[model samples]
Target: MSTKELINNIDSFVSTDVWSPLDPYKDEKIIFQKGDGAYIWDINGKRYVDFINGKGSILLGHNDSDINQLLIESISNKSSTVTGPHQYIVALSEIILRDLKRDHYKIAYFSTGTEAVKASVNMVRMASKKSIILSSGYHGWDPLWYHDNGPHELNKNDILDVFFVPDLLKRAITNNKGNIAAFVISPDYVYLSEKTYNELFSICREHEIYIICDDVKQGYRYRSGNSLEMVGERADLYVFAKGLSNGNRLSCVVGPEQVMEFSRDFTYTSYYELLPYISALGTLKKMRNQNGYMQIRNIGATFLNNLREILKNSPIDMNVNGNGNLFQFVFPNDEIEEKFYRLCLLNGLLFFNGDNQCPNLAITNEVYDFVLKVITQVIEQLSSNYNTGSFSINDERRFISAWRQMDGASDFIDTSDRLIIINKLFSE
Candidate 1:
């Protein structure tokens, strides 16, 4: 069937119009058929560079040969699932522990980052004997961590929200003292500073509240280990997913034995699935052998630097946020952001518009250059339209409206100066 027909059929039965927050463009959605490396093909056989990268879950990029082979082997061996623990799980656990450099820390498996986060929160609550959790950044879709305006009604008193400001965090801690169980942080290193994280960690430590580092999105991209190690701080619990098994369904919550022992009470049937274990093992081994993390970091750095330089001279007033491997474009107005999104889509570049652009290991220098070229063209076209006084004020507002309704839309503000200064100090 054609793309439109398939979409129509999906609309007939699918409960929602879009699957995830990353899928914002409902009216102009591209029905992707297949992906290889950094690119994906639509039902019409058109190719586009995929910067979304499975919403940052694809560590080695789509259809990685080693990961594919390992998956095939596991399936052929009829070891994809078993009644009990298996060798693949043990091997993968060993590698994870070694990378963490903390042998005493225990791990509990889950199928998604959301589940891992939920498990971590539950463990912390049980261990600390407190119900209140002060959180920052996006944790997951679970109602326990959702904002006050989330789709479902929230308890309002359970999970309190705070920004990166030290004073704000301190006040929240002071007000909720003794009742606070844990401070859950899903660090967005782009806007967050190591100093701030250290201060927050120190506060949580002082109050004896467990620190749960929700590294679901940022994990495995910056380095092989957890974000705590990278930032020179530690957490009582760590949640990892996304890039765990490239694109396979796997997530893990790791912590000291004292806290992780609570996970046994929350057993899941599919937690011990064998294919994801094998996939994670292969992905981690390949990443270490090839030094893939450094390469991804370098690629991201180059792309961000070059893009920043290009944007500096453009007539458009777009701001760029994030590090080398993961970043985003912040537009001054919704109209221009919408225009840029549609233009890039029209020109065979699929950026995670209104969110992050997750560059993968498969995005080589050449691919990045092509992506930059397309972005430049899009910017130039946008500038030309504005210069000629032909820019559309009547452009459809649905996409931008949907994006604003999402949780991270608060980041759309112009904080270029603060972000640049923080990033500069961070690099040094």
Candidate 2:
């Protein structure tokens, strides 16, 4: 069938797909036909360089040869989901632990990121015996701590509602002063992080709070280990996904053995076992190949440097944010950013941020070059538009005020909407 037919026949995979929502990220509406190394073709046969990477899951690209072969072998064995230990799973788990360099990186398999997340949350909360879960919205959706403080931004995903970071979670953790459950955080700054992680970890440690780092988005493509590598092996719980199976349905939460033991008491689950093996084998093999890490990091560095060159040459104000395989290119004004998003779409690039404020993980040398070139063209065209004059700090502040009212921040908030405030001063 054509890409259109594929979209028409989509399973939607929402309520039935492990905590997935009906139309999360609004991507369900887009028709995708086939995916190659770093590009996906729509039913219309219009190939677009994919930056989403299944939301950064497919680090090695869609349908990688190695992963696909393992998948076929695993599927043929009819051992997709089993009750007992399997060589594939054990190998995977062992490889995963070994790769993370946590001699005690004891892992329990989960079918999806959400399950991994839920399991991690329960483990930490139980171990810590606290209820506060501090984190950005990237962690799988589950009941650990309430994201009710409201400053977090809500986006409609094709499968579920996503509460993203823009709000400060630590403020609440500090203010509440109750025994906190787990402090979950993304290593990257995309979610309300101003490199406050060092202090945040220190505070959580001081309070005896379990510091849970969600390395889902930045798992493999960027660093040697997930950004959690910097945190040392001491975190009470750390969850990893994406790049594990080269993008297959695999995720694991590694924590102190005692903390992970908390999962023994509660047995809620949704994931299949095959994915664990797939993730383990794929990640292990890739890492052992040795050059994978430097290849991705170098590719990413090249891509970033090119972006900086583009921004320097462009008349528009733009900057790249975050780092390594998971960075986002930020434009000066939301309108231009939004316009560039559409423009990128027109140029056959699938940018994630519809608002143009954030475009992440272009992936691969060719795709990255294509995306940078397109961005260069867009900036050149928009730069000459006097009406598109670079936005200033004051202008950004005004935009934030208006955006807050428009986004319903006037009504409620969870942590301080500091991202909104901080983003305002970050101009072109």
Candidate 3:
């Protein structure tokens, strides 16, 4: 069947169209066929350079030969999935602990980052015997942690929200006082500083509140281990997923003996799955051997620097935020941002519009050069249309709202203090 027919069939049965909500093209959606490295092809045989990278889960890139081989071998050996615990789980845990330098921490397996975050939140609450959870950054879509109009009514008393700003965080802590059980922070290196992190850590530590580092999205992308280690501070518990298994269904919560012991009360059948464990083992081993983390960082840094250089003399007042591995474009307004997004899609460049772009290790030099060329062209077009007063906002093509809803971009608190810091760091 054709792409249109397939989409029609899907629309007939699928209750929600989750994938194409942010796709600017309202007429037709691009149905992806296959992906290898930093590129994906639609069913129509059109190719696009994919910067989304499975929403930052494709660490080593899509269809990695080594990871594929490992899965095949495991399945052929009759060891892919079993009814009980397996050796791969133990081995992967050892490697994870050693890499994180947290030898005292134990691991609990889960299928998704959301599951891991939920498990971590429950563990912290149970261990502390406190109901309040002061949280910052995205922690999955579970109703227990996520609510569109703020904390859900049931969880309002349980989850209090805060921003990365030190003063804001301090106020939340003071307001909640001894009621706060733990401060769950999902670090965004782009919006926060090491000094701020240390301050937050100290504040929570002083009040005897447990710290749960929700490193689900920014975990392996930023560094080899979790974001906690990169900031020179440790958390009471760490939640890791996304790139953990390089696009496979795997997530894990790791913490010390006392904190992790609470996990015994939370168990599920699929937690014993062995395929994801094997995938994690292979992905981790390959990353270490090839220095994949550093390579990714370098690629992202180089791309950002080059893009900045290209945009330096442009007419548009645009800025890029975050580090090499993860960054986003801060357009002057919604119209310009949507224009850029539409142009990029037209040019066969898939960026995470209105969200962060996660560059992976599989992006070759050729891919980088091609992406830069497309971006340069897109910028030039945007500049001409914007400067010539020909830029008109398409009312029917609105995508920022959908993007914000899909990725929770609007959920973040972008304080003026944080903006000043980001501007200073990325200033030309």
Candidate 4:
């Protein structure tokens, strides 16, 4: 189909908001209607290597035998819920709890990541006996008490009293002191290890502050059992979602029984009837049976490191930054970024723009190697033509001025300053 037609079709569904016709995606809409393994097919039936990985949920690849079989079995068995018990539910939760070996942690099956997140914060507040929270996280939107994400632009529910840095905790403590309830951070996929995880955990521990680690996007990327096991003794509550079920809607909350289980004061209830429970259960089983994490994670790491080698001399400052098996790319600037994107499109390679979210995965050895070759080729092509960098200081000022003109941002972000930050982070 023509670009105009694609744009029209998308506009029909999303006239406004993020997916609206005014967005950048309006021009790039591929309208992929089908996917299998690492390839997704657009409306015009063009197949591309899906690096976006259904925004990181397609790690098992489009339709794997195991996930597909379990999904079909779920339909075949019909759905069930509880205040009662089911064997598969018991078994799945057991696997999660068992592998992690945290006797105090309890697992719940949620319909979405944000749902799990909302539930977690509510629990933390209930146990902390405090009103405010200090967070260094990109948790999902829920109205609690937000101090970041720039105020009301994302809605009050999504905002919770969150602090983006540990220093903020210091500043807040002087003013608010014991009033602060919790400190939340994503130990994985969190920007700059120098700043976030280890230090935040230590501070939270020292202060006796509640630590909530949001691992929604990074969990199960490499390890199945409590993905932030590396957080190392500071988190009072832990949350994970992204890799829990590939594309299946499954998220989990597990932490110290001392804090999480005490949230009985607040109501945390889901209908508890979801087919994805079985999907998640079966996923754990399959991973167990195949030793999936061990095999696939090693494969993924090797693949990523090889790409880094290929791009070693490229003028564009690209960094392959991630842990275990998760994948993401950072680019120098907008012009180079646009060029990288076009090259991927022409060769049918896929990757996200900003965070690159989670790069999709190949479940099998053969599929992984084939696509890795294509990606290697694409990187080589991009490297040869690499013209370096996005968002000039002037452009940053324009965006700021435009937003300010249209009322204003609740959060204070110096765009000119951020330009420097982004550049420094991407530089090897």
Q: Which candidate comes out best when scored by lDDT?
A: 1
Whole-structure CA lDDT of model 3: 0.75
What lDDT tens digits, residue by residue, belong to model 1 across residues 1-428? 87778888887879864545435466676777899999989889999998888889988989998889988887888776656788887888887777787758988888899888988988888887888887776777777764554321224648876545455568878887788888888876665557778888888888888888888888887888786677798887888998688988999999999889888877678767788888888888888898988899888789889999998888887767767677777776767887888888888888776777888888898998998899999999989888524333221222233233223212333334333433443355
Lowest-lDDT window of 10 residues in candidate 1? 393-402
Give each model a TM-score: 0.88, 0.76, 0.88, 0.78
Would you give me the overall lDDT of model 1?
A: 0.76
As a whole number from 0 to 100, the lDDT of residue 365 in candidate 2 is: 74
What tens-digit string does per-residue lDDT give for candidate 2 at 49-86? 77666766666666666767877887797867655555
Off by over 4 Å in 3: 147-157, 388-428
RMSD of each: 6.1, 6.7, 5.5, 6.6
Ranking by lDDT: 1, 3, 4, 2
- As for TM-score, the candidate ahead, 1 or 2, is 1
Off by more than 4 A, model 1: 17-24, 149-157, 387-428
Better of 2 and 3 by TM-score: 3
Candidate 3: residue 354 lDDT (0-100): 73
lDDT of 4 by residue, 1-428 (tens): 67667668666777545442112344566566788876878777887776667557666677777788877776777655545446766776777677667666776556677877767877777777776665554565554534334431222443333234455456655666676677766544323344345665676677787777676766666667655665454356667777767687778777777666755543234435555677676666666676766676677677667777766755545666554356555555555555666666666766565444344445455655665677566667766664343222343433333221111211234434543433333352
Question: Compared with the true structure, what per-residue lDDT tens digits does model 3 show for residues 283-357?
Answer: 888888998888887877787898888777777777676666887787667778888888888888888767778
